[model samples]
Target: MNNHSRRRFLSDVGKGMLVAGIGSNLAMELGISNALANDDANALTFGSLEPLVDLMQQIPVEKLQPALVHEIQRGTELKTLVAAGALANARHFAGHDYVGFHTMMALMPAWRIAEELPQTEQPLPVLKVLYRNTARIQEAGGDERLHTAEPAKLADTRRGGERLLKDMYKGDMQSAERTFAALSQGERSNAYNDLQHLVQDAPDVHRVTLAWRAWDTLQLLGYEHAHTLLRQSVRYCVEREQERLKKDRPEPALRKLTPRLLDDYKLLSKKTGLRKTDDAWVEQLAQTFFAATREQAAEAAAEALAEGFAPEDIGEAMSLAANLLILHDPGRPEKWASPEKPKDSVHGASVGVHASDSANSWRNIARVTNQRNLVCSLLVGAWHTAGQTGYITDSPFAFDVDVITSKKLDADALLAELNTAVQAKNQSKAMAVVKSWEIAGNPAKPIFDCLRRYAVSEDGALHAEKYFRTVTEEFTTTRPEFRWRHLIGLARVSASEYGWPAPGRDQARDLLET
Candidate 1:
């Protein structure tokens, strides 16, 4: 074809009809007549001819037409999705309902596709996932798909997953309709309850796809939900990758296990791995994966993997996701440190966490439902620790590097310096003293030592025993140089009247007490 003729497929006058809702590449392959190409649906184009099209085109064209709907994410559906998203955002500001925030955010994007961006719509793959798990709605002898299930039942089962439980209790008489209904509802759950339900048990191809969409949707609603979801994905991908490894390794190690299911599973897993990460290699390979366009993020992720940074790259990928969450919520650190601010910033003798809420000590920031952020942090932290330690044969936890600085860093006198800084409300000096040990290449032990000698007793105004223990762990596990920065970040949020290096100035003396 001449360049001019070939270009006709793109020219305004020669614009070809794009069969959008359904991804049928067969129509493109059978040499779709140039006559019909410019005749119908607007000049839209399918991103690529996905293999799923092979199954799609097999159905009679008449039936395929009914299957496809030129669905637009406008009108009543648009209002509902936007309204629900707004409501979820409001609930999040209340400070106690993170899960509720995520839930309301997850199930709305099916109705809110963005304009002028080539974002992969989540609804289609979600449909493919449903098709794989549910009983065939296509008839045996005929082509018509008359199996229309109840929309309300499907919606209810998905929102709470209550229907799945009810169906299971029926012992021998489970309803096939209900089973399909339950599978259909699975999209909204985020597998928040059971990680495997999405990563392993659910259709393999859709796991990350589902996560990214929900992650994208929540952020669009202007709530800081992606970081939590990113943390969850790190765990999900690790576990799923581990399972894939075990299932695919050739022979012998199978011990008492079967090989048939294992082999097919390997093949299926490989196909899934290819599809999920393929786009990541081609386009925006480096634009800060999460914040960039979808194609860009995928390409960046692929480039990272190709550069021999697998497994760890996932953590690095997670780092991008974490940045998005943190950047979105400037006050999150302070909120995490002490969620409930005092009525008027008044200090009762000492500015500190209320003794009444003391029973909930340490405020274990690791949410039970999603510990991915904590786990991912530990992973990065260890990597940071080893690099600082010089990666020797007999690996010591802390490095021996003597970071150069203008000021003298006397380790033995750190406590006195810390006290001096805190008393003067000098955030910079106080933070520097606390961080000096880290700069000296052995922070964990010294930080712990400082806490042991000066931290007030069990019920002290500020509990450095517990807080210091966590910081010690962070020092030992995270990037050596950055560990102190994390503390500084924390202090930034938890600042008291005396200033932030030590929030609750009155109680600040408790931590520095000799």
Candidate 2:
């Protein structure tokens, strides 16, 4: 391409005209049609994402790894590869399918893992997730049809998030998409904050995590494609609501409970308190949430907020309540551990994983949303977490660490012990080790290093990577008083998911090498 044509191509990309699903004819008109390299080049690809999206959709599962390896060797950006994966995922699943959206939830974390890894090993997470994405795409018959299209503009600009959520509640997909598309063009936070209102209306882990991940991948995909990325959340909400209506299931009690708690506590109009609490206070709050009914838990959180507790404190207590689910989980029943879903144990798709992921997502949502939504999200989280307590095991995991013989072990020794416990799948010992390390006032890095190894390599039934990311993030953002609880939560999960290797690590390593 000459300088003039290069300038034209870049200019078109700047104007967002290189959108793949809708711009093939436009590419031909611009005489840069070769960029759409594959014969089946139709999906919502954009700018640098075009050819990779084409390859991901059209390449056979057996052949895609080498093709991706070729793309990377030829100077393709990892962000672009991840961007294409997101677009491919959005095009194919659009947050509608179960496995489909789980794949979507893992995309950003895969990129994060790749970013932090050694250069030679960097491609493992990306390749593994892409392999999963394409395999699912092929299973759905290798179609190029998009579940999400270019959204139409809302005719009335006066409509906003509340109206958009109302549209979803009514199961109106077109109006929801249009409202969200127009909203996406405005301040990005406002659009995301609006979406949290709907996301917290249900206790579904996939809904909350998908909403957070869709907004998160924007760091790679950029806000120019915000409409494309965010519309998935809108569509997800609509589909879930539609499914609920189809089954004649009653609306989630949170729909009414959240607002009632918000108004009753005057939380919508008030700024949250900056009050901090001690460990005893946190333990008391967590136990209250653990044992209370959903309505009672929401009221407790609202009461705490009204009486001037910091939002993060309330979120911390809520996270602990969710962690309690993991701590008390009954091991997977033998009948449920079949070859088809072999990882159907307490570490993966259990109620604990669901609760933990949902609470982690709620914490993330709380950070970005408005004060009103923050309050509502916390209340809803408290309610949602309280609901999960019904699944707690008959015998809760022991909290007292009898195995730790020394009180002053250095960080490395503590980590080595913790790692031993994790490898052995000794949940009690792992929990005790981390708790002892925390009590010794050691730095967190060694513990992080210890857990990250398992998180990187373990299958975790697909939850390990995302859950690791979740705890790492939540630990950083949470208050110092309450953060170690997240690490303990991580140890519990890591120990539970210790033995199984990730699905394609060896294959990804070989493909990257040769």
Candidate 3:
């Protein structure tokens, strides 16, 4: 073989290789087109996809494409094409002359083919393709791009409307409110109309979004607007699933709606026409509301009590009732008084009498000792309620005679001793003393009298005043009382150089004046 013959053979081989490559490329292109065509032929089409196009137009440029992608992936196959076609229209209508409409148009058919194929056989390998792209579009602020109108015209008002709805769904209440406010009346109406359409088509989704919007609107627009939104939401829930109006729906929206509905009923009950003479209806509403949500009903009941009863009386009654309940319970803080010491029994006899006929001359003194201790206990217990500073035992005389005489102690010392005895669980002594004190007479009388004496005395007077003042301050801040002693103390201190004698004297005075 010569050089010319070898060259000719190599050239022939090169041509063969080029022809094979061209053939392969042509086949691949044709296959892609065929697959797209087949998918388009089988794909569902819903009217010019104009509505979706219109919606996409409202989204911002950066968000527009990604959101379209998201809707396409998540929506029905037909819906996806509509979304894609709409996106293409949005791009073209925005007038970027460099990119052919066909290039924008091509994605619909490709997505359609992807939709038609089994999900496992779909190209681009992962679900992230849809999700990642959608998120990117959102992050890029694609929703804002939708606000642009055509070259000469403002964008479709509905575009802004949908954005508002989306903002509401996102819990961006401030933006939603601002957008709604910025819209002209006509635009606002159109937005709501669009919302109505969306909601009518997908009631479940609408319910969730509407409930959220209602709550946000309530925060932004005050109770009136919030109430209106709440009513609409309640109606929607009731219309969609009447069972929701019943007690069983655990959907937070539905649950929340029930309370709102009850509130509406209560409001209605205040009307002159229906509620003025209709006791049964009012009762029924009250019962239903209470049965539905006891906590709300209780709050309402409390408000009613405030309106119907004197505030002071109602408050005192509630406190007293609650305290009584606790007092009755053995485990409560105020249960038993301190115990007494054990003592021998005592027989009836004069103190100076001799033991003449001796069987056993002396008898146990338990009864007498217990009686005396009981008086002391009662005095101490009652002392707790004296003029916001001292105890007020059930009986003043019993404390003076049984507790004071037997123990040879003053009121303040008795109070300290009582506290110690109670803390030590000396219940028998505590109860005995308490009983004896109650039998003595107004038990708190002594405590107040003792406070008065201390307040006036020179020696230990300042110490007494400080103690009383501290105790009174604590009481005023916590369990304040308005008794004659407190009033008297106030009067006495009013003219003195020293400021109010008690710790919270100013507060106590204010309370008394009120």
Candidate 4:
């Protein structure tokens, strides 16, 4: 094809088509170009990821949905498509771009969502995120860049983790990457465990969730790619450390505090306890964390673990402390009502959401990590929750169930009221309805069923899907009496962001429907 002919072909294809949503060579292999009756094209492909990753990166933003939908129809596995997206993201953005990483956070949740949907519609969530993924790749000009760091030798096997943390904290990217690469070759779980130090370095939602999500994604992508997946967290930590140093911010106190807490509590030497505590103990621990200073919170958590309280029980208390932030949040109504505020500003990405996600991550991390990391994670979760003290109002976000005329409303009626409150963006009413349902001895299933509808449909500023999944997983892991609280938090947040659809949600849906 001549230059003029190619130009004429692009113009004839319509300006709205934007970039191609498949690699040029793969397009040829799939006979996709022949389908379009075009014969000539040029593009780059990375043999490491081959056709799928290249195809994902080449996808035009406007056509990602239709393109993915086509691939699904042609017998492509959804997991393969998602793996490609993850590889494409890690390769291009290397865990640096805001949009790139947020999309990365959503990948596993989107895959989970796809599993529950009917076959034809299963790809919706996957396509929605891929659209965002490819759009950012398009904006950045493309995914020609590759992760170029070569693996290095660890000087001392016993102290590699220590050296890695020190290098990361000092903003030494080259040293950290090399150290992480060396560690990545040793043992998959051990490699993942070492990085938990950085995940718990501070309470940033993106940092914690990305680390957890990347680990979660490994289950799908397989542990063989663990190094590539886990490297994102290392890079993220080094980048943040660099920024903090450049801005002259104080070193995060947790850097020093976490290690001290582990030693003072003798936590590193103790085995994680398996004894579950009673409801009163859980409540008391939660209150202690709620009112304690950051140091006090860490101490209380250390003491609990030292005293043989189950890490899950200790985590339950931290989870309650997080729910308290949402239940007691005092932001003015206009803050949520503003068109200018990001949809997730108050509810989706609020301090409460961050706390919940962070606590959830730390809790799960404790389950899989080594004893030292388990100890560090519990302490970090408590400290993170208590750090948000300024956001806790004098009272709980008002959800007086006493206002209801009758406590005897059946499940359907209660759910109706809950949906009404959510649609109206009435946070207080939503909480009241959920509490009423809980008080009525109703099964929690009906309520989760109600929230699942909104979770799948709303854009939630990229948070709804993940937070809902977080709450659902935590519910099963939490004690019976306290489990209802997670539901109430979800209800309030779902209600708060009820009407704000994701920016391009309609277009993605329309593409799928047609």
Candidate 5:
């Protein structure tokens, strides 16, 4: 074994091993590529390619043909080619291009495509190719056309479904349901399941998606299914978020709940519950929520109300909802009514027009009147409780009455007195006097005379007339036993004094006869 011979032998062995290794590596690489090609070929088509092609063929050539031409002119990159392949498979076959030709070749059965490839190296270039081809096809109005359910449209739908699923997983069911509804059933199912996994791991997300799905399903299915779904979702949310729910515990739970507070909570619960039951419940709940929480529920309820919910129902729902909300945190301060006006304005005792000299009582009456203005309905209810509309009637001013009187005075004397008051422009005094006389239960002659004589001068006369008309109508309709002899008498005098024609005097005559 000479040195030269040993070196040559070593070199030869190294060369042979290197060559063998290279051959093995190439074989493995080729084998892997073939397997990948095979897998790619078998990848899901969702549906037949011909249908997509047919649909694409139907798309206006002007709209889709141009894009295909542009892509062909541009030639295909891998992304563009993949896009083209997808387009071709989806039946968007416009015409041949180097990229599409290569893509089809790569996807050919003899190519032995793979099931999946690393995303970074995946043939997204095919997408660009497809885009260009589709563009040309769309522009030229070639064989390939766009349709409502084109591959591109379906791809977009799929993308939207993915986004919706993500949102649902994050506990945005409303959005998810919306996205789901826009998708085909297969896409919807995929999104729904994705959301389910998210819900299981992240309960908040689950709760939200469940509620949204339930609500959406209800729209599709009906009440029973929807309610069941809602209940299930709510239960899941409530249970899963039990720790969060604990935040609602009142600091001092032992305090006796005020009737008002209890009422508020009851109202809130009722409103929220009603929303789950009635289609229009959302509107009412929103109103109640807003009323209770100073418009917190406004956004939620706005859509429902805009769709046309009844105002009264909304009001009641808001009241109920507010009550429920208050129960969860009863430490809220009470809202007080505004302060009352000074008593002198109301009792008229300061004007010396009334016989009642009870100063403190008059002041109280004024205070009550001021309160009445602030809360008319509440005050009215309270008055009704007191079993007397006459509480207002018996007063020297007769809060409800609007007239003037003067006993032992002729019509001329009454007119003169009224005229003097009018001339002096003592409108307040005139009204006060009129109201006093009416309160005193005087006959209509003096009251009507005073009004007619001075009405031209006194601004209060307008208010007086309205009151007179209201009272006259009420008395005429309600008190059948009391023939409106006073009204008739006053009408006759009014005609005489005002110098109006008596063409309708027959009506007055009939009233008198009655």
Candidate 6:
């Protein structure tokens, strides 16, 4: 544990990252693969080794409560406006929807990463090389080739892949149903095992748990929307799994390295009573997603562990999360909102509650603004408390950085167009402007203008306020997609500022009528 060894360890990491640098044109592989941590005696661990666990990894591990608290205070706005309110209302604004949950879902994890490493040796240089390298491959269209790749990275055989999404999006319901039905439970189970292993072993569990804890924090504060939370929170897991799969490792190697137990499952079980449990964690997670009393969600998670739900249960949960991810890839966050076409519905039904089946079919009602990012602070907190961060996050490049180097967006003009769309109650149009915004390079000023003008909740307002003004201004060469997503939500909230609801069943169908 001397400086000499630490220096060597970091140097080795740098070498691997350099090999995987942006110039290599290979999709980046995340995790501490082939790193010296395996050899090092003093490997750094995240969360706590004992009872006073970071739990949500929010305050203790991530020191994220301030950020969450800050976001809640700054972003909230009333229908009619007067800047943000004087004081914050965490409970009032927490469950504003998936957008807020998603914002934190992404934000908290990044913060946790920053918190994990030693502040003295800023690791951005190392992470930059790896992220840039991986992004190069993705940008070059290599990562998506698993279906056609030489090794065929991971198998999607019976479960399904993006093809199912295309079918659904293209209104091929018959084909979609056949594909969904064709998924033999056996194949699904197998795939789940692989995915579960991925979840238990993936390096990004730190980030995923960070996001999960963020969900619980939101729910505990009062933001709960069950189906929406489950649907979206799963995306974080998908994000991690995708990042892992992009490395194009073979199945056998993955299985070999993948931990059979995330840790001493028995020890974890005894500590938190979460051993050999069932879908209790699912329900525990649901209480928060559904926005139950903090007490209810806490009790549920505790009870699940008391019943013996261990990481295997988490593996099953990851399987479901992976399926949801395939159903909706994390890479294409933009697709979350395609113009809702009535014919897209199979039987004029919506997959979730309160969704209008006026068109009479199973439809993809998911939108970026779905606002169900179930921070899972409680659920994740339980796991984080029971076990370690379950991640060897000693590397600098924990995630792909979307460096902010693009053309500038005209804050005033974009706002004008965005305002017009919102005032017009044109959901599609407003969405278009948000997505189509050539919002790049020094766009923070304009981004903030939108935040102040139309922030959906205090959380969104706060996050946007600080990020645009501070993070973008301070950091360089990072993925601005998170910002883009945030801005998109701001636009949606702005558009809905005057009570313009997301066009309901019959109303949405009427779009074709016009």
Of candidates 5 and 1, the better by TM-score: 1
Evaluate model 3: give its lDDT: 0.29
Off by over 4 Å in 3: 1-307, 332-413, 427-514
Writing each residue's lDDT as its tens digit, candidate 5 over 467-507 gives 22322432332222222322322222122123221122222
Give me the candidate number with maximum lDDT: 4
lDDT of 1 by residue, 272-294 (tens): 12223232432222125334433
Location of the lowest summed lDDT over 10 successive residues in candidate 3: 352-361
Best by TM-score: 4
Please list the C-alpha lDDT of all candidates, in the order they appear.
0.30, 0.76, 0.29, 0.77, 0.29, 0.29
Measured with C-alpha atoms, the lDDT of residue 494 in candidate 3 is 17
lDDT of 5: 0.29
Q: Which parts of model 6 are misplaced by more than 4 Å? A: 1-411, 438-442, 456-478, 500-514
Error of 6 at 114 (Å): 27
- RMSD values for the candidates in order, in angstroms, are 24.5, 6.0, 33.9, 5.8, 34.0, 25.3
TM-score of model number 3 = 0.19
Residues 1-514 of candidate 3 have per-residue lDDT tens digits of 2333322333334333422443545423322111111112212222333334333323343333333333334543543433433343323222111122212222332233334344433322111122222233334343222221112132555465355445544444344434443433343333343333223222332343333333332322334232223334333433433343254544433234333433543422432121121334333432332132333433443343323322223222222221221112222123322121112101111010001000000001111122222121111111111111011112211112254337655545655544444344343333333333334433544433333322322111112222233223222322223222222222122112122132222332232231
lDDT score for residue 254 of model 5: 10
Reference-based TM-score of each model? 0.29, 0.85, 0.19, 0.87, 0.17, 0.23
Model 5 residue 322 distance off true place after TM-score fit, in angstroms = 32
lDDT, candidate 4, 1-514, per-residue tens = 3443442344334212322544565444433332222333322223334455655665456655666666676677888888879888887787888888888888888888778777767777777777778888888774344365667776665666677779987899988888888888888898888888778886577788888888988877888788877888888888999999999998888978988888887887868888889999999999888878988999999999889989888999998888778778764355454563443335666777778887888887877888877788889889988866776677777778987536667778888999999998888889889888888888998898788777767767668778887888878888888889999999988887778776557776775683
- Cα lDDT of model 6 by residue, 1-514, tens digit: 4444542355454434433442233212212222342333332221111011111111121222222222223442111010111001111122222333323333322233323334421122112211222222223331111110011222455334344434333344344333433332233333222222222222232333322333333322223222122223223344434444567644422132212222312223244333553345543443242333323333444444445555334323322221221112111123333333222111001111001110000011101111111112223322322221121122211111222112233656656766777666454455556565643343545554453433212222112222222222212211243335334433443443333222121221232131
**Two-way TM-score contest, 4 vs 5, winner:** 4
